[model samples]
Target: RDCARPQPRREVAAAAGVRAAGVRRAERGELRAVAGFFVEEFFLGRTTDPTDRARCFKSLCADQSRDFSRRYGTSDSAMLIAEDADGELIGCVGVNFGRVPAPDESSADGPFALVANLAVARRGRRRGLAKKLMAAAEAFVREDLEEEEAILLVDQKNVPARRLYERLGYKRRWADPDAKALEVVDGSVVAQPVLNLCMRKNVSGSAGALVENLRWQDVALLAAIVAGVAWRDRLAELADPLSRLLDELVTAIPAP
Candidate 1:
């Protein structure tokens, strides 16, 4: 008997006659590439205090690679990663099989794939690396399971994410009419603070795309908050105005 692990076919985009981003189905255990950079920073500032922050972060980081272990990188699910020519993982997408019971009892629960844990490194932003990862996940659900649609929950406040999915072809579909709220797990001890909007995309034959993970917008908002705090000395003069601006910026940014 002969045995050699199959290498996922790499797809590339050509721009100016040069290969841009490439995407592939990450084999089992490849998720470590994602946990290394994306997960670490994603959880750093979310914890409450200095003493326990690192401890909490460590746990959260490990969860990224382990949460979907049932099908992660195996035949049952897809862990697609987008990398540069240097083989660095810049973006990742997860698609796991499950059932999303219909909004009403009119139809029984059918095979559905849940798209989650999408992340893209800062260096890879605005470069279409995310779209690449999404394409791979959709393909897995469509071709592997012969499913027509994949369902995902997006934070109701995340406009960029909503717009991204809309561009790729997902829409609200909690019922025959209105989308419904879903109380999803937030972390080790609580449910998400805000309602998660239910969205679905048609992928049975040919269709497209979809983390709520800490994003660039969050980093910038954090920076703005730190800067405003630093200006505490000028409270009588510039502090109020600067604080107002920071408030607006914070409101504009969606929570992860």
Candidate 2:
């Protein structure tokens, strides 16, 4: 099932010196603004040429436009934005549903609600805008998309981001420690890849995951359970009297 309607706008309290912000799904009219934010925060630093900036901005807008249509059209993904009281775009995050292929071929792969492109403007820093954006993204995944878990990648060098995600209940997942992703640097793809840490959170409240799709970690856990049971039975055989006493105690209990 898919959720076609985007969430309504939600107001978030700002920091003491910062303006209050509102978060919601980006509209078609705000596509340029959304693209501008990415260029300003991520691309501008790479070059000083206005021509390059323009090209980057156009590329980002086109990419985001496709994303926007996919969300409202197919309900499979969304790009969320946070704007200050003045209606200036300050932060953004994206939630997408897809399969993240395991870096190691031997590992398992499954569908997940992926969180990506989380960014906040310099003016919006220290105002908790990132957290608000994150909250909104997770809400879309959980309430709107009916997903149980979400995953994201954070640069290990970004200590603050990592700390923030950990505080939000995201835990480290099994991933290639040396994995790298292609990154845009200087308005172009750089030869070097960015290192990242894989993190995951259960958005569904305390609900056990269905075993329909199992990861290698799940197999390991099941193996541990089996080994534990085998060891317990072996110990019970070595302690026959204790086992018999426990069996007698169980039999002594009256059936309701």
Candidate 3:
């Protein structure tokens, strides 16, 4: 059956292993997590977004998210987030649709769509949340916005994100001849001039395809939940072990 397109968009897809991924619209309350994420990953590091401080995170999310909602023919243009049952904001992505500049005349002056603000929190790393978010965004662009392709930009230094994009069937849509350096706001960049690459995936005729990605964040969240449930009265007894495991799981991910 075709996935029904409606105002409150949410989708779930099956993956290869035990992990299942779902995609859906961002709730009004999740603004903090979404903003904090951008601050932690982009602003804290190096990003081109005009706002460079955590104090500006909420306003930035609102403005960009508002524009995302207002874009013609793309309700999926709004930000999307992935989370665990504990309501943790596991990952997020944003979609945009408008008249994007075409490199060659052959491409139509399009209401082309782009995906931005893609990330999973550092502690929440290794979960395939990024893949699921992109897939759902592409599906919305194809079916709802009636677009054929979804576009995104990746920093050359962000090799991990680049690899995930490639695995999801995104190809080199365009490459900047003169890419700008990756921006690290509250954070530091060891080098200057990080290269930016554009990637794209075809969304035509692809919807309701289930995908799965194992997430350390998911695992950690679930373990914490289960332990809390089984040992509600023994909270103090489990705290030490849980803390140790959490640290181990998080620090193990090779930094990107």
TM-score-better candidate, 1 vs 3: 1
Model 3 agreement with the true structure over 83-189: per-residue lDDT tens digits:
66545566777776755455567755466687777776554556566667777788777777678777777886778888787767666756554656434445333
lDDT for predicted candidate 1 compared with the true structure? 0.65
- Model 2, range 1-256, lDDT digits (tens) per residue? 9976653344234343235688988765666567667657854555677877777667665775566556433457778988776677778888887666567777556677889878888767776888889889988988988988898888787798888887677877755556664445666644454567778888775535334234556668899999999999998787988888899999999999
Model 1 misplaced regions, further than 4 Å:
1-19, 41-53, 101-109, 175-190, 205-256
**lDDT scores for all predictions?**
0.65, 0.72, 0.62
Answer with 1 or 2, whichever has the higher lDDT. Answer: 2
Clashes of each: 1, 0, 16
Shift of residue 3 alpha carbon in model 2, Å: 48
Candidates in order, TM-scores: namely 0.60, 0.63, 0.56
The pairs that clash in candidate 1 are: 148-204
Task: List candidate 3 stretches off by more than 4 Å.
Answer: 1-22, 28-33, 45-76, 99-109, 179-182, 185-194, 206-256
